[model samples]
Target chain A: MQILLASSFGAYLFALFRKEFIYAGVLLQLAYLLFRASELGRLPLVGPHDTIVFFTACAAAFSLPFGRLMKGEKAFGNIISVSSALFTALALVYEPRNFPLPPVLKTFWFETHVVLAFMSYALFGVAAVFGYLYLKAPQSLAETLQYKAVLIAYCLFTLSMIFGGIWAYLAWGTYWLWTPKELWTSILWIFYSFYLHARLRQWWAGRPAAVLGIAGFGVVMFTYLGVSLLMKSSHSF
Target chain B: MNPLKKIYQILLSLNTSLWLLLIITALFIAGAFIMPDNPGFGSIDIPLFDWLKRQNLESVWWLWGTIGVLSLLSVNTLFCSIDSIIKKRRVTHWLLLISPQVIHTGFLFMLLAHLLGASGSYHGEAAVAEGSAVKLSGGDILAIKNIEIETDDSGYLSGWGVDIEYNHSGNFTESARISPNSPFIYKDLNIMVKDVQAYPEAALLQVSRDPGAVWALAGSILFTLGILTLIALRMKMEKT
Candidate 1:
């Protein structure tokens, strides 16, 4: 399965360079995602390895629409391909196991919380790619794409945090625990909130927004992975 | 200009709100780094304000500073939201004009909920064997009827639940099964099984009461709706 994913990503890269096999590459990636989801018997979002693979699939899927709209379809595909390959390779580090879902995660709220949060992360991942490119090329389309992607991501992040809080209340009898994961997640949210507010100012619209978007992705990665690995908390993956 | 009007203008300034938010964010980051490393520091069982008050002010000045800045930010948020609502009252795109205000209103409600919870919430833990009764706040009693623990093939606990009966003023009341991710709520009180011991067949339960949970939930829902509305309007504008 991993080899198939890696091969599809390679195909995406080839399509990025050639610009002729883009549809075929997209179809291959989508098929791989479908196969993995069917095999898992649930959404491919339960564990870290599953989440990384699922995120890779989402990045490829999202690139199709966002790429066309931004007029940088090939560049977007290249970014998605690189990111998917990197994450899929990272997913291989964790030992594969068929552990049953923990009792605390056997709730609808938990599924909603994790899925929305990860989807937002994938959107922000795309935004960061465009944001970096905008910094390099300084195009209006890339700037607009970065802004819209972050806008959608910010909204989804808000929902994910709310859902997570509700799930915590159900499981632990508290909405907010102020654990390291919770605190850093709040920081990430506030970072993007500041970014959105700053974008409204005439002085901070284009280059500064791009910079912040890229920086916000750094915060997202730290919040998603760093806190779990470094800090002892209930959310440790 | 009148002094009261001057104060209102200052309060309503976007720059002031931005500065306040920045300061609060900084303080939060500082607190995250500077605070003592306790695994259970932020759990519901720990009353944050009460714990802070018990600590020496000189030692935990950052916490007090954070709280003070947050209060000022709340005021700033309220004034700015009201100012925007009044200024945009005549705009044609009412949804776009008011969406941010809806989010602001939600923020204020969540702050209010936190304030109410800080003042009135109660939390405690109790270890109860089967047929043991623990007295809760407001003179209510919780009686443990039975405790069940499901184990996997390796004898590791897969799941656990406690059957509890509530006695209100010596009158028999409702019974509930409290399990992981599922808590039993009686009025504003919530009871959940935290852990289980097999030798004596006892369950460690956590009990808490927060009157502001509903308000916080309502505020979160409103905030989500406001953001969705804003996004929908913006997307439509982009499409057009």
Candidate 2:
């Protein structure tokens, strides 16, 4: 699956270089998603490996319409394709095992929380890609796209946090824990809140907002991977 | 200008909010990275403010500062919401104007819930074997009736369930099945089976009373709805 995703991303790059190969890349992306879903017997969002693949799929899928919407902006597509490929490769490196779901995880809130959180992360990833593109090209459309993506991501992230709190309360008898993961998650949310508010200010609206968007993705990466790997916390996933 | 009016202006200042947010973020980042791991803080019964005060003052000065900033931010949020509502009363885009206030109100409600919970909540755990009773505060008692555990092929625990009977004033009130995801709520108390031990055949049940959970949940829902409404209205305005 990783190989196919990497190859599909390569095809996307090739299509960007040679404009006529776009359909081949799209077909490969769709095939990869289908194969992965079939293999997992569900959406590719169960574990770390699956989540990475799922995020890569989302980036590739969004790139199709985004690429078409912003014609002559092949760089945006290239950025997303490269990022997706990198994530897919990272997924392979992480090599998440298909452990059976624990009883605690077999809840509606767990699925909703994980899915929404990952979806928001993927959107933020895209926004970061756009932020980079905007810094390079300074297009109004890129700015708008980055803002819109962050808006949606913020909403989903909020919902994910809330659902997580509810799940925590159900399992642990506490809604808010001052664990490292929770702290970082709150920081990520606050950072974006600042970003959103700053975007409204005239001085910070354009390139500065783009910079914050990119920086926010760095925070997102740290929140997602850093706490899990670098720190000891209750969020074992 | 009157002193009270000056304070209100300061609280309503967006500049104050931005600065407070920055400080709070920095403090949280420091807490996440620098503070030693203390599992005891996760308990609902621990009053965070009291606990912070009890910590080594030198080591946790940042925490103290963070609390101060957060308190200020809460006040700022309240005043900012009021100021916005008053200022934007005649604005044609009522949805756009009010959505942020709704989010602010939700934020305040959540903060208030945390405050109420920190002072009034109770949390404790008890290990009870089958047919044993655990006494709780307010003269409540919980009796464990049965313990069921399901194991996979490798003898690993797949699932576990506990049947508990709530007794108040020595009278049986209700029975509940407590499982991993399903917690029993009796009055304001939540009873959840935390762990199961074999041989001894005991279940560790955590009981907590959080009077503010409902308010916090409602606040979260309202906050989410407010953001969605703001986004929808903004999108519509952009389209138009």
lDDT of 2 by residue, B59-124 (tens): 567777876898899988888787788888897578888899898888888878888786777778
Pairs in clash, predicted candidate 2:
none
Clashing pairs in 1: none
Please state the CAPRI-style docking class of candidate 2.
Answer: medium
lDDT of 2 at A196: 85
- lDDT by residue (A1-237, candidate 1, tens digit) is 666666765665676566445455556656765676678555556657767666666666676788778664466667776676677677667644456566787788888888788888888888998888888889888888888889898998889988998888888777877666777787788788887887877777889899989988998898888877777657844
Give TM-scores for every candidate, taking all chains together and pairing residue i with residue i. 0.91, 0.92
* Candidate 2 chain A minimal-lDDT segment of 10 residues: A40-49
| TM-scores of chain A in all candidate models | 0.89, 0.86
Encode model 2's per-residue lDDT on A1-237: one tens digit a residue.
666766765675675566545555557656876786677544445646766666666666656666676788878776765566577667667765555666787788887888788778888888898899899989889888888889999999999999998998898877887678888898999999888888877888889999999999999989888887888767654
Task: Point out where model 2 deviates above 4 Å.
Answer: A1-47, B1-4, B37-45
